[model samples]
Structure formats: structure tokens, C-alpha cells
Target: MKAVEYRLPKEFDKSFIVFKEQGLYFPCPWHYHPEYEFVLVNKSSGRRMVGDHIGTFLEGDLVLMGPSLPHVWVNDQKYFEKENTETADAVVVHFLKDFLGENFFNLPESEPLKKILNLSNRGLVILGHTRYQITKIMNAMPRQNGLKRLSSLFEIFDILANSSEYELLASPSYMENTRDMYSDRFSKITEYILRNFHRDITLKEVADQANMATTTFCNFFKEHFRMTFVEYLNAIRIGHVCKLLADRDKTIISVAYECGFNNLANFNRQFKRLKDMTPKEYRKALEAEPMIA
Candidate 1:
């Protein structure tokens, strides 16, 4: 079993730090830290895991996460292949709550900012006009220093605190202190599930991998994932199936089996259950929208 890595910022005297990174892939694993983070993905597409939430993120993705939240952006396999020409790029900002001062948020005028900070504990995905606006600021922060950079950060907070164009990434009931989630048993189980969800996985096999009885494994999975094991596996499959459905060439039956569904009836059933629409309806919605190639 592998452990979720914990990371710390390099020893520095500053109140905050910003990084502009470009690489073949995002190398960070499931990890958490004490500093709040603002990350802007300037290039590449990938799966983003924030707390118990899992979804795909594209270029121009921007998200804010509060202290001690587990998160990572895992690039697709193509990004790591030797012959791939593209690179992944991002701008990340890290700061302590007291970056301004220990009591800055106690000021009467800071109420709005305080509220935004509190909501960020569940993680925030900047959207609509706000995302476009922040992309510029985040890209510029890596070049500025001193008061100029600090002012830019304050401006960012002001924009986010005032806008309604954001969504919480994690659930309100999501356990933030995931020490138990990072335990050796849970880590091994998660690794196995993510790698093999598209195959015929039996409860007994996974339980054996976790060195737990099947019943104990089921309870443990529900406790951490907030869903039944079958539900979690279906969600992972449906997420990938949605991705494949984007290609107009793939038939529904083929896509279903490709994503590991053994039967069309079961595939359509779980697809609608998780996505609230049948595969055909989902494809129709996609067709109606003029998606950019």
C-alpha cells in the first residue's frame, strides 16, 4: 500500500509563493498541505481529484482550495508518452491564511472575503467571466514581486469574493482531515480500483487486496467514499464513458462495453442513474451544442 504524500513549501521568508510550471506531465500525487492554493491550468487536459470529487479539467481550468485539502491533476497517458510533443503548463499560488496579517479578516470590511475563504474549504472552481478574468492575473503573478504582486493577489480575492460565478468542488459533508483516507489499506484499495475499474472486479478480489474481509471492505469503502462500492465503480466507469461519448464515431453499445459494462441494459441503467439521462439523450445534447474541435 502506498501513502498519500504530504508536501511543504520550501523554506522562505515571504508570506506567499507563486509557481509557473511547464512539463511533460503533472507529477504530484494525492497530497495535502497547510497553505491555501490557487491553481490555473494554462495548458493540457486531465482528471482532477479534489477531496472526494473526481472530474475532468481542461485548459484554462482554475480552482481554489483551502488548507489541508487533498488534490491533484493527473494528466492523460498521452502526455507522458515519449513521442508526445505537447507539454502541461500551470500557474499556482500558495499562501497562508495570515498572509496579509493574523487579524486581517477580522476587519469589518473583510466580511465578504472571510465568507469566500470559508467556502473555499470545500474547494472552489472559478467559472464564467471570473475564470477568464483570473487567468490573466495568475499568469502575470509569476513575473511581479513585492507590493505589486501582493496587490494583485488582493485584487484576485476581491474579484472572487464578489462574483457569483463559482461552484464548490467538494461536498459540504466531505471529511477534510483525511488521515484515515491516506492509510496503507485505503491507499492500496484506491490504487487498485482506479487502475482496474474498467475490468470485471469482484468484491472478494478487492477485499483480498486490502487484506480485509469482503464485508469489512464494503463498510470501509462506504465510510470513506460516501457511496457503496458498486456505486463508486459505476461512477468511475460513467465518467470515462462520458469522455468517449464525445466522439461521434463511437456507437453506444461499443462505448458501453469499452468502458467495462457487460450488458447494454445495465450500462444504460447506470448511465441514466449517475448522469440523469440515457446515453442517447446525452449524445443528442452534445450534438446540439456546437462543440469546438
Candidate 2:
């Protein structure tokens, strides 16, 4: 399995760091960081894996990740093709809990800011009009320095603290175990599963990959991921199928087979169980969209 990589900003001495990059994939492997992160996807689209949550992400998506959360932005392969004209871009801000000094949150003036950081503990996805407002703040980060940068970060947090237009992505149970020591093991398992999910994977295969007994692997996975091994595999398969469905010319039967289902009946059943809609309905909905945004 490939090792998970995390990019920490260099040049900034403060607990909070902000940086931007162009034409570069973040290359974040299913790794976690001690500091909280706010990532704005200005121009990229791919599968977004945060904790146990998986979804299709696009440009203008803004995500807030809490401390010790595992995540990665796997850029689509098509974007990296030689003939492709567009490149990936992003703005990321990372900060520790004590970035504002030890007593800052306790101060009366910092009440709102404290609330915002607290809300971020569960991880939030800012959407609708709120995303644009935050993007403006991020757009200005590159020009600021010293006290100005710190002040701007505080202002951004204020907006997040007061906004009600965000959604929490991780479950409360997962949030409670943020400090659990099994993250590395979980990362190994997930990385293996993600890499080999397209093939026929069995319990022994995954368990051996984790270097644990089948029983132990099952118990550990359920305890941390909140789902059984089969459940997780099916979820990944369904997510892949959705991506294929977006291509109008693809046939439902072909997509089902390509996604690793042994038979169409099994694929249809699993798709309906996970998505609550048939493949035809799912494809039709995508066609109805005027645009992906």
C-alpha cells in the first residue's frame, strides 16, 4: 500500500498557516493532522474522502476538517492527461487549537470565535452563499502577513461561527473517538480496500493486508469505521457506479459489470439498497442536470 502523505506549511512560525498552490495535486493520503484545516477547492474535481465520508467533489467546494481527521483529494485521472487544458488548484489553511493564545477563547470578546471552533470539532461543509463569502476571505490571505493575517483568520472564523448554512459530515460517534489510537491501522485497511476494491476482495484478503486475524479485523473495522467490511466495500462500489452513470453513453449493464459486481441482479439490488434509486433513475437524474454544478 502507498503511504499516506500530509503537507504542512513551512515558512509560517505561527500556529496557523495559509498557502495556495496551482497545477498541483495535494497528494494527501488517508492521513490525519493534529491541526484543523479549512480547504477551498477553487478549481478541481474528484472523489473526496474525509474520515468515513465519501462523495464527489467539484470546484467551489469548501470543507472544514477537525483535528486528527483522515482525508484526501484524489484528482481525476482525466485532468492529468497530456491533452487536458485545465489544472487543479486549491487554497488551504491549517491552524492548531491554541493558535489564538491559551486564554483567548476564555475572553468575553472571543465568545463567538470559541463557538465557531467548537462547531468545527465535528467538521462542517460550508455551502450556498456562505461559500462565496468565505472564498473572498481566502482570496485575500496571500497578501496579508503578521497581525493582518491573524486578524483575517479571526474574521473568517466569525463568519463560520454565525452561519447556519453548513452541514456536519461525520457522525457524532466518530467525533467522540477522534483521539483513538487505532487511526494508523484504520488508514492501512482503508488504503488497501480503496486500492483493491475494484477486484474481488474477501475477508481474509483484507485481514491479511492489515496483518490481523479475520475476527480481529472485523471487530476493529466495525469499531472505528462504524460499518462492516462488506458494507464499506459496497459503498465504494456504489460511489464508483455513480461516477460512471454520469456518462450518458454508458449502458447500465456495462457499468454494473465494470464496477465489479458479479451479476446485474446483485448490482441492481446493492445500488438500490445504498442509493435508494435504480440505475436508470440515477442516470436519468444526471442527464436532467443542466450542469454538474
Candidate 3:
């Protein structure tokens, strides 16, 4: 159960680097920089692996990733189907944590900002009004220079620091072990779980796949992923349930069985626990959304 490891740069430069990516889907290999990253996904949809957090990311998503956290954005294969035609754009701003210097946190006036950055240790995903503001700022960043760029970058952080609508994605363990095992372990475990979630997967089974003892695997999994093995499995099942609910042809009972629940009652309970809604309610909500091609 090796964890993904990354190296951080030594120096903390005050300036920010702006990157504009076009037609690019897959992110850089699992890696981390010493500098904090503000990412605005103008157009893209795919799975994002940030530290131990895993989830689907849609276009117009905005996130603020803390410094030295292993992360990658994997684009959906559909994006590459036509080869040269697919175009996805992203604006990324990277700056050193010390860019604001020691006084940034020392000053009482900056307490709120410090609190937000501190919260980022657990990994934050900005949404709602704050995300919209950050996206606008990031979109304008590449066209600006010097003091203007600096101001825009600070404004983005200010939005993040003050927003209550954001969500924490990564677990506490991910915050503690910024440099964990190797990237292959994460890929291996993720692929295995995705393939075998419909079947009975025990701790021993997963540990065997990683060539580690069951106990060691549990500790490693919990440390890096911030959840027990069973909890992670349940989350995968719940995600599958969401997909099934969105399909009009699948009945709730059939979906529960298909998702590997042994009993309908247990499935209903778990679904409600994870989703905070009954299966029917979840489907109704999806039905209300505009269809995606």
C-alpha cells in the first residue's frame, strides 16, 4: 500500500505564474509544487484525483489546491475521440505560500485569510458565487501584468478566504502526509476498486493486490485516503447508485442489487445516508437538470 509521493520546490517566489491550457485533458503526472495553485477549469469534464480525494469534475469547476499536495486531472476518453477537434481550456495561477510574507498571517487584519489558507490544508473546492468570481479573475489574469495581475490573484484568494460555500474534499490524513508513497499505488488501488466494486472486496483482497499485509494496508489506506476501506467501498457503491438512478430504465431494487447491496433495506438505508435523499428523490433531481449530450 504505497502512497503517492511528490517533491516540492525549495524557494518561495513572490510572483505568480499563469498557465493557459487548450485542448488538453489529462493533467501532469501526479506531482506537487511548493507553491499554492488556483485552478479554473473553463472547459473540461473528467475524474480528478487530488491527494486522496477522487471525484468527477465538470466544466466550469474551480478549485484552490494547497501547496505540495499530490494531484492530477484525468480527462475523459470521449474528449480525445476526434483527435484534433477537442478543445478544453484551463487557467492556472501558481504562487508561493510566502508570497505575502510573514506579516501576512501575523497581522490581525489578515486573520480571515489565514483561516482560509489553513482550511485549505484539508483541500478546498470553491463553488457557487465564489467560484464564479474566481473564474472571472483567472480568465482575466493572462491578459494583465505586474500590479494588475497581483491584484487579481489576491482578489481570488480573498474570495476563497471569505466564502462559506466551499467544500473540503481531501481527508485530514492527506493533509498530514503531503509526501506519501508512490503514484503507482494510487493508480493500482483505484483501478482495482473501480473494476471490482461490484464484487465482494475484502481488506485482504485489496492488501494482496498491493503486496502488503491486511493491517498495513488498512493503516495506509486510512492514512492516505482518510477513510476506512469499507467506507471507501460504500462511497463507490453510492456513486454507482447515482448513475443507475439517473437511468430511467433501472428500478431502485434492481440498481441496489446491481450495485452489490445484499438487501433492498440495506441499500435504501445506505443510499439515504450517503445522499441525504431517497433514490426516487435523487432521480427526480437529475431529471430536472438539462440533459447533457
TM-scores of all predicted structures: 0.60, 0.58, 0.58
Tens-digit lDDT string for candidate 1 (183-288): 8887788778778977999999999999999999899999866688888788778766866776888998899988889988999998877656788876664453
How would you encode candidate 2's per-residue C-alpha lDDT over 200-250 as one tens digit per residue? 999998999888999998998887656798887887787678767767678
In model 3, the runs with Cα more than 4 Å from the true position are 1-14, 82-84, 177-293
The CA lDDT at 163 in model 2 is 81
Query: What ranking of all candidate models by TM-score puts the best one first?
Result: 1, 2, 3
- How does candidate 2 score on lDDT? 0.72
lDDT of 3 by residue, 160-186 (tens): 767787876654434433332236876
Q: Which residue pairs show collisions in model 3?
A: 3-181, 3-182
The runs of at least 3 residues in candidate 2 whose Cα sits more than 4 Å from the true structure, single-residue gaps closed, are: 1-7, 12-15, 177-293
lDDT of 2 at 290: 23
Q: Which pairs of residues have clashing backbones in candidate 2?
A: none
**Candidate of highest TM-score:** 1
Off-target runs (Cα >4 Å) in candidate 1 are: 1-5, 8-13, 175-293
